[model samples]
Target: MRELTESETRVLFEKLSKYIGRNITDLIDRPDEPFCFRLQKDRVYYVSEKLAKLASNVSRDNLLSLGVCMGKFTKSGKFNLHITALDILAQYALWLKPSGEMSYLYGNHVLKAHIQKMSEDCPQHQGVIICSANDQPMGFAVSARAAVECKTLEPTAIVGYHQADLGEYLRGEETLA
Candidate 1:
């Protein structure tokens, strides 16, 4: 594990804080000369160094940076959330029913009927993270309607579209050409 310097940690925290919409650096981490987090077997979750790198880029470029590995959840059950640090911080989340989970994971948009719940994170048409009922972050999505208006939407209405669903591994079925 690489121990980050004070400035490095501060820079990382600031960048993430802005994207996540929360000042929660200390909640998940501690400030030290060399700040680092070791994922313990007993721990349920932890963010990866890749997140910091991505955040740095977003911070430097002032854009929405998409990362491949944001964070992970341990089956050990130390925590209940299996989401990327970025999504967790963004505050907008959508919980989908089992049927929706299948469709979303298979690269389809979630309809209102398939949705189990939605978080009051961002305004309508804003970006939101879609998760399974288990609280596992599945992918990024854009809210089809405002937070308050989402509930009034029809069951078959489009709730959000899957932008990233960690389907790269499942996409490796191509044979050498």
Candidate 2:
């Protein structure tokens, strides 16, 4: 594991900013403690400065991973978010109806019929956290329509595009482990 290069940080921040917006500052400069991002293999880990310092003592060959596995960099350089980062990215969310939870867990995109509520100011084509009506985050998605547009759309209209979900824990257990 090593520090991210300047270009790598830029790419990762750009992607994260899309989902979390200004909240990126909260991740980097926490009130409790200092934290940082580290690169291990192709994965980026959100680790604390203290923990990272301790982890650095271990040999690279034996250190499999560090703190939270935020995401990974694709071979082409685009950053792909892992489901593990959902907690940190749970600021803006779209609440789904109880009946629609199963479909999203099955990796299906959220339809207009599934939406129970959402941030009123939510705009179209923006990243949003998909949550259960009870306020549990299910995963990440891109809004298919603006908050106002959903009110006029048919039940079958797409509301959010699925990105990553809890189902991936079962589907990609090997990689996650």
Q: What tens digits encode model 1's per-residue C-alpha lDDT throughout 98-156?
A: 87788887888879888887666556666567778887777777677776777677778
Q: Candidate 1: TM-score?
A: 0.53
At residue 116, candidate 1 shows an lDDT of: 83
Name model 2 segments beyond 4 Å from true: 171-177
lDDT of 2 by residue, 1-177 (tens): 899999999999999977877778899999999899999989999999999999989988899999999999999999999888887777667889999999999999999999998888788888899989998889999988889888999999999999889988887788964
RMSD of each predicted structure = 11.6, 2.0
For each candidate, the alpha-carbon lDDT, in order, equals: 0.55, 0.90
Q: Which residue pairs in candidate 1 have backbone atoms (N, alpha carbon, C) closer than 3 angstroms, thus clashing?
A: 20-89, 113-155
Of candidate 1, the 10-residue stretch with the lowest lDDT total is 34-43
- Report RMSD for candidate 1: 11.6
Off by over 4 Å in 1: 1-19, 23-92, 175-177
TM-score of each: 0.53, 0.91
